[model samples]
Target: MSFIIDDTDIPEDDVILFSILYSCVTVVFAMAVLSKFLTNEFRFGFRSALSLAVLFLGEPLCQFFVKGPIGVVCFAVGCLLVYSILPASHLPVGNKAVLITGCDSGFGNALVAKLDSIGMQVFAGCLDKDGPGAVSLRHSCSDRVHLLQLDVTKDEDIQAAVSIVQAHVGSEGLWGLVSNAGVCYIGELEMISEWITRKVMDINLFGAIKVTKSFLPLMRPAKGRIIIVSSVLGRISFEGYGIYGISKHGLIAYADTLRQEMRKWDIKVSLIEPTGYATENTSDSSMRLKREEIWDTMDEQTKATYGREYLDEIYNNLLGIFKMLPDDLTPVIRAMRSGLLSKRPRERYPCGAGADFVTYIFGLLPIWISDKVTMSMSAMPKTAKPRIQMIQ
Candidate 1:
């Protein structure tokens, strides 16, 4: 085949290079299309895969063969193809009902506004009814948005929420349940006591499970979705983030198990594993003070082994991660929106650019390499060897 574009400024060698690179890109894109389809059981239809493949291959192929500028035409065609097959979530979802926990702030609050803007009935679950986020949502959203007090850790609060949601959803049934309420704590495992461990796990993991269980009856009727907000730490663990990571890790397992069991009712379960974003959980002041408090609780033997200097360095490193977190929470909100509104939802939605790589790719590497790479992010304190001269 003649692979050259006529009347082009492109050189022959450059064409060869572009062709090779474009081929690789095309293959990868095709693989993604195949993988997404097989895993989702062709949820979007064959056209969805075709549309995506065309979007990836068309533009590049046009540039290589037809004309470099023809790539623009391919992009336009690809967009239209995708639009035709895209689900209803792209537009307003009216009449459908969704309940979001932790609407007091962060992704949950933003999602309430987004869904409300689209004319969907939103139930905003807040731990603090009078808190700033709930107040803002109540004022901004339409009458369809209802604010309900919910504490995921408490059975009474969860049961109360269930009743409120049932009353609201009624015959229509709840279309979505978003488990976004959770807490984060930073410290080594040794420093974090059994109480702290239970506290973190209870809220982050058990709390999500509690909310989901309460709403399952409603969701089962509508074949609705359950979207859990997890962290990238759920996919990759680090040194100081032990407690937080454990909770998220447990959440992932629960979500995965629920996804299978719920298949009988066609209820969708999706985990939004997002890169850290700027939220109350990632607040600089709260985390720094938290580290100090956790350090004070450590036993003398543990403190001596790790030393205060190590804690200081770790505290500083934690600050860096929080600072680097993106201010926007849109990616996570969008993922939940997709799960709630789409015909076929992915099992796992990793938010942000390189998330899939870390979640899927990096996880496949050798354990030693992965461990070294994670630990190398910051140094761990070294313990001194015990003297043998006394025994001799």
Candidate 2:
């Protein structure tokens, strides 16, 4: 049937065409502006930029040019092309294998299930094989998912994992290695002791390196992908995220170098940065309690030097992340899969709501300006509480 129209009104075809054209142009323009920032943040080069442009604008572009019933057909075809252009690794599900660390909870746990569902052989490296998440994951997948006890920092655990993965893949070599284990605790430079500092670095920085190194040989022949899970804080650092920021900064640097070096070996490397997505104990209340715990550890003199109010302020600021972050981590999982499977994956994927803002805009900003802006939101957690009585 034809698109019949009243004499008083514009033709329906014209209206439809205008709407589709306007929508496509508007969305593409907005995404173009976003590209300026995302490109810097994630190093989203030409390929990624083009892929995303098509993915975001294809349907409207298709619908506008192809009329009526034909438009619907064209829209589907455009969407398929857009999806196909994006970096996505495709292999027989059960044929490929990936080992992911920190599979006990959060992104790691979620990704393990996602990969397993699609048919990949998943070696889920949980900190505790007997943990609730591991047990749950095991129950869900009887085969193709193996849960191994892993502590990224420990030598023995790494060796055992290498042995396990080698046994499964044989001459084929492992297809992917994901460094997803990390920890975060908030405190000032001096407030945290050398021991705590070392622990954080050992797990978040050194541990990932250890895992990657151990599995490199297996991946070499297989020409696999190394996926590093980093935080937005890797680029943007501030008060409460001091040590964690240091570790992430180091991690990103390490991953960047690895990506460049691995290129010659035909092995891919990608970094996935997510904003304040909920991890097992990363809730606002849990972090507040953690801050309280850290406060309790301070020596009396130290406590007196930095009052409880100061720590409270820091924790309160930390909670600001919860407001911006989404609980669901599907974007992160998709990124992981793309890096793992896609023949030409991105060097970095910044997923989640504020990931780009934190990495690109905030990271690129002048420190003084950022400091001023952040401080206005809440006073920098003071080294010492003001002595109001002295003023009186």
Candidate 3:
């Protein structure tokens, strides 16, 4: 009648063999789970789920087979060892050339150094080749890194870049094309002028498309990789950043379609979607200035529609959020490197903390649930109560 009526009739050797068999099965499961966790952009949810699985399923299975606490410890140690030695699928980097746009600053500029350090031939496309960001890249990177004065928004620049790249690579062909050039603009949809919207779309959406298309011929010969840097907002729209999100959203659509179409040619396409980071484009001070500029430029009626206090409140809350953002661009740079060099590259790299969770919710949840979840996020429009009628 007790819980201890166990395996008294079973042979000791038989029991030991069963334990070893279960341990092997568990090791395979653990390896698969750990590999998915790392390669799938480090999803925090996956880590949580892994913990739950181990607690509920793994514990019982281990107890039934191995019959001791020591078995559990051994299992954990095995998982750790497996993760430590997980093999990365990386292509040969020697003599491979990669072209990255938006090298004037931020992720693009940082990635130039990263690729150059890895001994990959880097073609850094800067909007202003003589600017400070470009100059720093020139000084920091080795001779393998070449600087090209290229603007994504300009057809002339795109054609010139093609010619320059063709001349250098010759018959070898370009190995990678990273469409990292983009502009950030955050404003209410109504408050945003037509020109401003076009500017954002031109740089963030059309520019990326043109750059990718222009490089496809070269990429086809080498069966190169295409990595597009988008934002988490591209997947889930946020208040006060409609235009910027739209542009990114467009890139998401383009990249997804291009991936399927390029399968025949063996070209790989990937998307890097990151959350807020302390880059020049997302600097708190610069954002504040940009918000203030939008406010200053609004006409009387438009201003009346949204009071000055409303704009300030939105930006103030956002500034607080921005201040807490991680300044390190390493995770994003690593994603780009993997996208370019990995033999089996991931289709989407969601970089940043909580990014995968948020994207998962928005992508799967219902509209109402997503709205509620979005509200829970910090510095959103729902939190900012706007007064439409200004007092005299």
Candidate 4:
């Protein structure tokens, strides 16, 4: 029943031993958590890990290691615990404003509604301001949501948007810029022509770059956030998505460079890399049409070599992958929200079912091994016979 401990009853050696054991256990667990979360989730590479090691262990080595363990444990645990909680506690929305591109549909359209509901001023940049998605947002959202016609690939459109956004925001500046406009192209590498590749790149990679550059002036003063909606394909490429994967991969490179450069201004850049999801572009009918268009563009020799059935098999393989995808966009929406509002936003968010596991395994594995694994999982089914035959 006594609340006090008797120092006389316990030996001094036992107290030292107990403290050492406790510190050892705490340090091991802390290291594991930091390695898993920092390397995989935050995408912090080797340099950051080395710097963190110095930070966590520096004090522990000082003062002949006495009182060092307690200090290290307290610092690591306290800082990480607070860091975990900070992301969930969003910043005050207040009168802050955000502009989301590709608002005509999908993630951009959904994010517009979500941010607007939370009281942030929203500029919904639609490819067509009169389009159904834009009209729906106009009718559904509050007076604070403004709709602008923003086609990212067009220099004129991007410039006009800058002018419009600047006129409205004045000196307060834009709080966030979501470069969500993108197009997908799924076909064999040979089937995808230079023209097709260029078209996809125009919207997915170059468009995003141009839009971000134009808005940097507006965002620089506010030290705003930049969220790029990339794809899981950015980390790992598949057999049929050559063009799409290339564009997304380019985005990964651009975001990395931009993140480091923006640090001086305190602007944060984040990427949302989602796996397969049921969206308008990924619908069965739309994909079918795209397949047909690609097929039509091929020459006689090309068609004969790859064959109709072989091409059909590619489409079938994509549908099989889609079957496993979640139709719910909630995960992606939450990631976008975190990227915009979190106190400590992740560098890259792998969103969707098994996205983290999939990206990690395939992204880090040797290319040969990853290719074999990818083929085993979702490669195109073989045709009955080889398509090559004597032309004569």
The candidate scoring highest on lDDT is: 3
**What's the candidate order when arranged by decreasing TM-score?**
3, 4, 1, 2
Candidate 3 structure quality by residue, lDDT tens digits, 1-392: 55432676457886676567556657676667566567643434455465446645764555565554455565566455544433246777978999999999899999999899889999999999999999998888899998999999999999999999999998889999999998886767888777778888999999998888888899888888999999998999776778888999899999999999999999999999999898888787788778877887777788887788877877787888878889999889988988998766889888888776778877888888787766577364665555577556
TM-score of 3: 0.83
RMSD of each: 8.6, 8.7, 5.2, 7.5
For all candidates in order, the CA lDDT equals 0.77, 0.77, 0.81, 0.80
Q: Model 1, 1-392: lDDT tens per residue? A: 67575745777786676556555645555565556456442344345656666866676667656654355455555555565454333333767899999888889899999998878998898999889888898888899999988988999989988898888778778988999998877767876767778888888999998888878888877778889988889978887788999899999999999999998998889999988789877787777777777777777666766677767776676777678879888777777888887776778888875676688877788988888888887334434221223222
- Model 1 misplacement above 4 A: 1-92, 307-309, 378-392
Q: Which 10 successive residues of model 2 have the least lDDT summed?
A: 383-392
Clashes of 1: 0
Candidates 1 and 3: which is better by lDDT? 3
Model 4 poorest ten-residue lDDT run: 59-68
Residue-level lDDT tens digits of model 4 in 1-392 = 75334455447786576457556645654565566455333334343454466446643443134333454465455445534532344578877899999998888999999998889999999999999999999899999899999999899999998999999899989999999998887877887767778889999999999999999999988888999989998888787778899999999999999999999999999999998888877878878988887888777877888889887888887877677667788788888888888777889888876787788777578899998877676546654443777888
What lDDT tens digits, residue by residue, belong to model 2 across residues 1-392? 64543334547776677567546654654465455345332335444565566656655554445445455556555545544544443544557899999998899999988888888899999999998989999998859999999999999999999998999999999989999998888877767656778888999999999999999999987888899988877876766678898999998999999999998999999998877677775876668777776776666666766677777776775677556657788778878887887667888888876565556677677889988766565325545452233212
Q: What is the TM-score of each candidate against the true structure?
A: 0.76, 0.74, 0.83, 0.79
What local lDDT does model 4 show for residue 192? 75
The local lDDT score (0 to 100) that residue 105 gets in candidate 2 is 87
Candidate 1: worst-modelled 10 consecutive residues by lDDT: 383-392
- Candidate 2 ranges beyond 4 A from true positions: 1-94, 284-289, 296-300, 316-324, 376-392
Query: What TM value does model 1 have?
Result: 0.76
